[model samples]
Target: MATFNLKTVAALLFLILSGCATYQTKVNDARNAIASENPEQAVALLKPLAEEESRDQLVYLLDYATALQQARKFKESAQAYQKAAQIAEVQDYYSVSKITASLVLTEEMAQYKGDDYEKVLINAMNAVNYLEMGNLDEALVEVKQLNLKLYKYRTEAKKNYEQNPYAYYLGAMIWEAQRSFDDAYIAYKNVYDIDPNYGPIKADLLRSARLAQRPDELSKWQKQFGESAPSVDLKNSGEVVLIFEQGWGPRKESRPENRRFPQLKPVYARTQRAKLEVANQSATTNEIFSVERVAIKTLNDDYARLVGSRVAGIGAKAVLADQVRQKNELLGAVAWIALNATDRADVRQWSTLPESFQIARMTLKPGKYKVKAIGLDAYGSESGEQMPEREIEVRAGKKVFVSWRSVR
Candidate 1:
């Protein structure tokens, strides 16, 4: 039998445990900054790790890109998002070595590849970044990539994968901006199919149909909606879309009873919804996607796999400890304690993700108008929190985009 060095094993375990904690600590600090509505501070905290390439670079990139976007560093944010898309992708088949490490130590022992829904969100958010940069080609490319991945997911990951309404809705907006009314209509149909009850879906469908010259679809919607397709004077009225984020995503907390699996808990939020006001008219935002629900559901969906892995890891470690104990009881006991100490769950996530995503749209006459994002409570009352007034020049026959975030 090979001789085992108790001191060496203990030292190594200490390093791994402390290293994971340190990295998570940095991410938590950044998350706190974001929650405080100080995105610049959050970016400063994560900028070092996010700018570098590392094993945990995916986490750094996701949070960093979000922070940069909130800080209005769109170009730099786009670069981080681009890097994450290219390099941090997790493949279907992981390396044996990675699996071995995870089994021997912790799931976090392997690389921190993002979750399934997160991967799709990356493409959608990247498309937004490209749109903000005025690069229509790249924006469209990102949307196309998002749909392709969604299709693969339907056949590969889940046989009956439910469509993400937000992704398709975003694609519709982009297509409309590019004046591809036909394509926009198709994407809007996907969104409508996924969420027939969404407040703005009907209006968007009617508008796209009229613009695309689909008389039959327009008449069909007109009858079903019990309203006529509102006239869209393409040469006189411009479209304005406000994509806003509310609150912050939940935080992961390790339980004392089961450190091997972390529990997700909601983070506090002072703002729930927002209203976009321009000139004299305003539109109330509606929820499109919810990160809180999605995050909980994602973890719950993985519970079975996590349980299996945890049981196998503990069993293997217990057998090894018993083998060593047969030779030397004290060393065997030490081994058991040390091995169990590293059984921590990987609690890392995209810390800067919002609790939910919302949108508001308006058709305005051509003018340079001041736009305001006024935060509101569940009852539609002002919440005393607001975004700085920004100006938007609505050009005739064109669409424009604006985004805001509220977290306190």
Candidate 2:
């Protein structure tokens, strides 16, 4: 056998460690493209990157699909999301090589499986995309899959996990549209169970109860709120629900509490929410959920295990370096530097996500109307940012879904 060349090995390790880091520059380019309202450019940048079945696959897939969705290519977005959902189904099931690297070095060296919440959002986002494409059937399918995923997560985690209220709400709406009032009532009830405080939850519940002939539920709500359900003559009225995406979701950074594993960094969102105007009536959005908050909680949940694994890995590398030091001091020093140089918290996250999800709902008589969406501040004042005026035709007894996004 040939003699081991420590110098050559050390030099090669240095190069490998340095080169194995993420494509931060490319990711930033795609982010900049989306922020500048140029999603096509973002798509071009991430198209090839997403094809690599390596550590960055999930991140790139998410960014690419998000860009496609932002560009209003609903069909394309749905396809991309479908591909992502398949990968997410097998959460944390990376290849043997990825597992070895993660164990020997850092989790950052492994394929990014995404936070649990992010995995769930894959289907939730797809459900909405299906809604925009006016394919209620597919939307329902995605919702069912999303529900199944959440069920599995809760069972595995052995506790309650977050449920997407918007998904449930949309499912209810779709069921009602299909005249499946009984199913619609249950779906709406799920949304209420998750968040009864949601501004429109009661109104929706009341409507669903009357439609489904749930007299007891209707009376209970009426007594509690001391008000009847807002009369929406479903036979003649039309409804619209707006899903608003505002600012950017939280990012991860090293924090004092646990520097070994990153913490959720605060997002400085300029626009807090959005305001919608239609048919001489308007409603300001309310925060349904904070993606950033969920992100922080998930990070904390995984903190202890990750920090312990990282410490053990570093300790093993130190011992190896010490053993090598007895043979060649220079090579040992280089090897130590190379290994520790790449030691960092796995901060990669789905940066394209919105800071929070907000919603606005309205019911109007069937007609043609011009709709406008304006960004707002914390105090219910306009932020001087708005989507272009859009005209929507509402048919009698039908519902519509509209989505607006702002990168504040």
**Each candidate: how many clashes?**
0, 0
**lDDT (10s digit) by residue, model 2, range 4-27:** 655567565775657555555558
Q: What is the lDDT of residue 393 in candidate 1?
A: 89
The CA-based lDDT of model 1 is what?
0.82
- The root-mean-square deviation over C-alpha atoms between each candidate and the true structure, in angstroms, is 2.3, 2.4
Off by over 4 Å in 2: 1-13, 16-24, 157-160, 256-259
Question: TM-scores for all candidates?
Answer: 0.93, 0.93
**What C-alpha lDDT, on a 0 to 100 scale, does residue 282 get in candidate 1?**
93
**lDDT agreement with native, every candidate:** 0.82, 0.80
